[model samples]
Target: MDHAHIITELGHANITRRMLATHYAVDSEDEQLVRHIRRLLNRGDLENWKQRVHALWVTERSGVLNDAILGDVVHDEAMEVRTHAMHLLAERKDWNKTQQNWVLLALHDDHPNVQRAAANALSLHPNENHIRPLIQVRETTPDNDPQWLYGMRLALRNQLRDEDSWHSLMGYDFSEIDAERIADVAMAIPSESAGDFLVWMASKHEVKEDSLLQFFRHAARYASREQLNNLAHLVPRKFPNKSELQLELFQSVRQGLLERGEGMSPSILNWGSQMVRQIMQKNITSGETWSYHTIDGVKNTPNPWFLQVRSSADGDRDSTFICSLPAGGESYTGILRSPIFKCPEQMSFHLAGHDGYPDNPRQKKNGLRLVDSISGQVLQEAYAPRNDTAQPYTWNLLEFTGRNVFLEIIDADEGAAYAWLALGRLKPEVIPFPELSPNEEGKRLVSAAQLAGELRLNQYIPNLKEWIVGPVPDASVSIAAAKALSRLDEANLPARLSDLLQHSGKLGTAITALRKAMIAETHTTQRALLSEMVGMLPLRYQQEVMNLLSNHATSTGWLVTQIKEGRLSPLTLRNQVAYSKMESVVSGDVKILLKEWKDSLPAPNHLLQDLIERRSEGFDFQNANLTNGRALFELACSQCHQIAGEGALIGPQLDGVASRGVARLIEDILAPSRNMDPAFQVYLITMADGEVISGMPRREQGNAFVLADASGQELTVNLSNIRTRNLVSQSLMPDNFDELFDDQQFTDLVGFLLHDSSH
Candidate 1:
C-alpha cells in the first residue's frame, strides 16, 4: 500500500492491478491522485468507458461530482457507465436544480434499471414538480412494463400526502387508475380518496364489470373488515346480478368472511404431515382466501398486495399469479393475510427469508402469527428458521382445531436483511413423494417426525413409511421416520425395514445408519437386522460396504462386538493392503487393520497454513507479468471462474476480482475453509447405494440437484437418490497451488488476478 506503488498500479497496463490500485487510490489523500486520473473520466472515446467508470469510482470517494463529469456519466455512450452513474446519483439527494433535471432525464433513460434508479433518487426528494413528467412517463409506458417500477407511481404517492393533493390525477383515463392503484398507492391518497375514486369510476367512467369488480378485490386489501362487509352488501344490491358478476360478488363475500375470521370450514384448513412431501409435490397455490394489506395512515401497509404468494405452483405463472416483492426490488412494510378458517388438525405453509423477531412483541418483525378471531389473542406464533429458499413451516392445529383463527405473514422490519417474507399456499394434505431439492430442510424434517411420534399421530405414520422407504430420502428424514414409527410403537416397522434390505437402492442408506447407531446394543432388533443386511451386499459393493461401516465409526471394540458377540454377523473380505483376509479397520483380530493400515499412508498437505503465515508479503510480486498471469488463470482457474468471459462459471465470476484486494484473494485461494461463501459451498453427497460425490451445489431445477466439481463437470442427481448432503468446509477451488506452481508463478497468478486487462 505504498502511495507510489498504488499510483503506479492505477496507471498500469494490467487492468487487474490498475483496478486494485485505483481502489486504494479512492481512499488515498494524495492531492495528486485526482489530477492523475481526471482524463480517464473526461476522455470522450466510448471504447474507453471502463476507464471512465474507474475514474467515477475514484471521484465518487472524493465526495463531489461537477456537472461536466455528471453529464459524461448520465449521457455516456455506454449504458453500463450511465447505469453505474445513475446508481451513484440515486445515493445523492443534495443535487442542485440543474442536477435534478438530469435525474428527470434519467427517468426517461432507455434501460428500466437506470430509470428505476432515477425514480428512486427522485422519490427520495419528492416534490410537486415531479408529477407532470412522472405522468408523462407512465402514459407512454407499456402495460406489460411494471409501470410502478418506473418510480412514477411511487413519486405520485409521495406527492399526494392528502386527498386535496390528488386533484392533479383526476383527468387521466380511469384505466390508468388500475386495481394496484386502489390496493396500494399508499395512504398518501387517504381512505376518503379511495371512496371518491370508486365514485368517480362509477359515475363518470362506463367500464366493464370485470374492471369494476377488480376494484372491490383490490380494496379488500387495505379496507377494514367492516368496509369489506359494507362493500359486500352494496355490490349485490347496486349491481345487476349477471352470473359472472354474481360469482365475483360471492367471492367477495368469502373474502369478507376470511377478513373477519368468520365462515369457512375447519376441515378445509387441514394439512397432513406429508407437508414436506406435499410441498415437494410442488407448484401449490392456496385455495384459502388470501389478502394483502395495504397502508392505513398510522402503520404503513405495503403498496403492492403484501399477501401475494408464489410456490412451486408459480413456475407456469401468469400475470394473475401473486408474487412476493414484485420482482425482489420492491419493498413493502406490511402483512399478507390468511383467511379466518376453522383450524384443522394441522396447517402448514412454506416460508423463506427473515422470520421477524417475535421477541419484539408488538412489532414481531418478519413473523407469522395465528390469532384468535374473537378474543384477538395470539393463539400460536411461529417464525421461519432463516433461509433463502422456502422451508416448510407447520402448525399443529390440534389443540385449536375447530376454533376460528387466521394467519398473518407480517414484515414490520425495513432493514434490507430483515424485510423478506416469502410464503407458499396454506395446505392440508401431505403428498406421497415429496421433492428433496432444498439443502436446508434436514432439521425441520427431524423435528416434525419427532413431534408426530410424540403425539402418536397415527395419521402421519404413512408419511413416515414413505420417507423411510424412499429410494434416497435424506438420512435425517429416514432416521426421523424410523424413530417416529418406533415412537408410535408400530411393531411392523422393524419387519418393514428388514424387508427393505431387499431394496438395495434406498435402504443401503438405512444400512449405513444402523451401523453408526450400533455403539450400544440398545436397539437389538435393528442390530440383528443390520447383521443380516450386511451379508446381503454384493461383492462389487465390498469397498462401499466397508466405507459404510468405517465412515461414521468412532470405537473399534464396540463395532467388533456387534459382528462377534452381539448376535451380529461378520463379513469376510480380502484386505488389499496386507494382501490377507484375517480382518481390517472395521477391525483385525490382531495386527494390521483398516484404520491403522490407512494411517500408514502419507498425509496430504496443501500448505494452507504455511502460506497464511507468509501472507501477501511472502511473495515477490514486482516481477509479475500480466500476460503470463492470464495464461496461468486460463490453465488453472478458468474451469470454475470466468475472467474476460472465457471460462466456465462453476464459481463466482472474477471480473471484479480487484475489488476483493490481494490479501483476501490469497486467503481465498490457500485457505478457502476459513470463510466459506454459502452460495458456492461444496457439498459432499452420499447416495443410498453409498456412492459419494463432491461439488459446488447449483440451483435446484425442480427435482434435480445439480452439482459442479472443480473440473467443471456437472452431475445432476435426483433428490430422492441422495442419502445425505454434507456442506464441506473446503472450497471447490483446487488447493494444490503449491504443488502446481513455484513461488514466481504463484506471485504472477496473484498479480494477474488483481488486475483487469480487458479494457
Candidate 2:
C-alpha cells in the first residue's frame, strides 16, 4: 500500500499523538505492511494531508529522508509546503522550464532554504541564466561562502562558451563526443599557433600519460610547430627534464642555422658548457645577502647572516651579499647570483640580509635615487617598489635556481628604486608596456576585443567613430568604465529599442559612446541601458550608481510600473535585480507582494524582513539586530526546547516553531500543561536513553509503562541520546521574557522561525 492507503489505515487520529502514546511502538500487526505504508506515505500529497505533510516536512528539514516521503510532495498553493517541495525537487534536474523559472524566482524567495534550494538547483547547472544573478549576489555575500561567486563564475563560463577551458582544467565532463568527434573538436582550436602547446602536451607524461598520448601525438603532426614554438616561449615551462631538451642550445643553433642557411654556429655547442661552468663556479664561491632599513628609519642593518656591501667614498657604489648557515650546515655556499652585466660604481645593490626579512627594502626618507635600466636615466624617490608585505627589504629570492633581473632599493633615505639588474640569465627586454591613447578629441577610448563586444553600436563620437573605422586595433580600455556605461544605458532605456541600431560602429567602444550620448541626449532605450550598466560597476561605484538612478526616481518608478502593467517587458525587473535596486522598487502593495512572496516562498522571511527593514532603515545586515534573536535562542529557549534535533525533547522540538509562528509557539511554551500532547499524558520510568517510559496507570499492575523518544526507534531503551529525563513545571518553549527572550527579541525570533517538517 502507498502513503494514502497507510494513512487511511492509521485512521483519522492524530498519528503524532498516537505514536507518542504507544512510546513509538512498532505495531506487529502493521509490521508486515509497514514497508507498504511507508511507500504510500512517501507518495501521497503531503500538504493536503496536514499531519502526514507536517511530519514529512519536519523529517526532510531534519535530513531524515528515509522516513520523509519526498517524492509525493508537489508545488502547491501552500507557501510552506511548496517551498519544501521545491527544495526536494533539487534532486531532479529534469524539472521543466516552468519548474526552472520557479526555482529562479525562488532566488528572490523569502525563505532562506527556499532561496538556498533555488541556488542549489542553479548550482547544478550554473549556466547563462544563473550566472548574472549570481554575480550580483557576490558583493553582499561573505568571502568565505564561495558558493555564489563560484556558481556564477561557473555559469558564466558555460554561457560565454568557455566550456573547453573550464572542463579541461577542472576535470569536468563538458562534452559527450567520441574520439573521432574529439579530433573534429580539436581541429576547431582557435589558436593553432599554440601547436607548441599541443606538442608540450604530447611530451607531457601527465597530459598524454596514458592512452591519451595517441591522440595528442597524432594531432601534433598537424600542428604548425614553428608558431607553436613561438607561442611556447610565452607558456611557462617548469618541467624537471626541460633543461635536458637543450632548448637554449637548440634555439641558438636554429637561429644561426636559419640565418646563415644551413651553417650551424660553433658557439651553440660551447655555449651550454660555458654556462654550466659559470653557474657551478658562482654557486661554489658566491654568497647571498639580505638588506633592510630598520623600522625606526634610523639604522640600516645587513644582518649577520648576510654579506654587507657598504657604500664607498669612492665613485663606485658599495654592494653587499650575505649568507646564513642553517643549524646542521656550517657554511652557505649559495651564489650571489648577480646578473652578468657591466657593474656600476656608487650603486648600492640589494643583498639577502636575513632569511625572513625583506628581499627588497623601502626607503623611509624621500629623495632615494636609482637608475632606470631601459633609459639609464636617474629616477628618484620611488614608492615602495615591491608587494612584499611579509619581507620588506632588498634582494628577492628567486623561485628556482635561475638568474633574473631584479629591482634593488638604493638609498634607505631616498625611496628611489631601480630594477633590471640581471642577476643571472633573465634579461629585461626593452619592450614598452602598452597604454591606451585618447582620440583626436582627447577623449580616452579603448579599442580592444572586450571593448568591441561591449559597445557594438553607436559610431557618432569622433573618438568612438575612429575606433570603429580602423581595422581592429588591440588597445586597452578601463574595463570598469565600459561596464559603468553599459549599466547606464540599461537604466535610462529609451522608448524605442530600434533606435539603438542608429549608433552602430566598432562594437564595444561605439556602443558605449552612443549609449553615453543617448543618455545625455534623451530618455531613450540607450539611456535606460546606460542606467542599468551603472549597477554592474565595481563596488566602489555601487553607491554612486544608486545615487544616479535615484536622481531619476520618477522615471524609474514610471518604468517599473509600465513593466508591471505589461506595457513594457519584465526586462526592467531583470535590470533592477541586476542593479540590486529591488529595494527602491518594493513599496506599497507591490512592496507587500514582494515581501509576502519572498517570505512565503524560497526567500527566508528573516532575510526579506532584514533587507526591507535595512533598506528602509538604512543599514547593512551586519549592523542589523537579527543576531539578537539567535543569541536568545542559544541562551534560554535551548534549555528545554529542541530545534533541528539539538535540544531537549522534555519539551517539543522548536525547529518547526518558526513555521508555527512566534506567538503560538510562545503561548504554547508559556503554558505547556494547557495544550500538552495527549499522547505524552502517561508517566513512565525515565530511561537512560532519553526515552520517556509511559503507560496507562493500572491498579493491579501498578503504574503501567510507555516510552517516547525523538527518533521513532521505539524501544525500552536503557540508553538514550539524552542523559537525564524529568518532569518540568515550565512549558517546553520557556516563555519567560527576561532570561529566555526579550520582548523585541521575541518578536524578531518569532519573525525568523516558521518551519514545517516533511516527515
> What lDDT tens digits, residue by residue, belong to model 2 across residues 42-99?
6663334444544443344344445134433443434555555665656655666556
Candidate 1 per-residue C-alpha lDDT over 438-541 given as tens digits, one digit per residue, 9 for 90 to 100? 21233445555665664467766666655554422134455566667765753332422322332333445655544333222245665555555555554333
* Model 1's TM-score against the true structure: 0.30
Cα deviation of 456, candidate 2, in Å: 46
Model 2 root mean square deviation, Cα atoms: 35.6
| TM-scores for candidates 1 onward, in order | 0.30, 0.22
Whole-model alpha-carbon lDDT for candidate 1: 0.55
Clashes of 2: 111
lDDT of each: 0.55, 0.35
Candidate 1's error at 138, in angstroms?
2.6
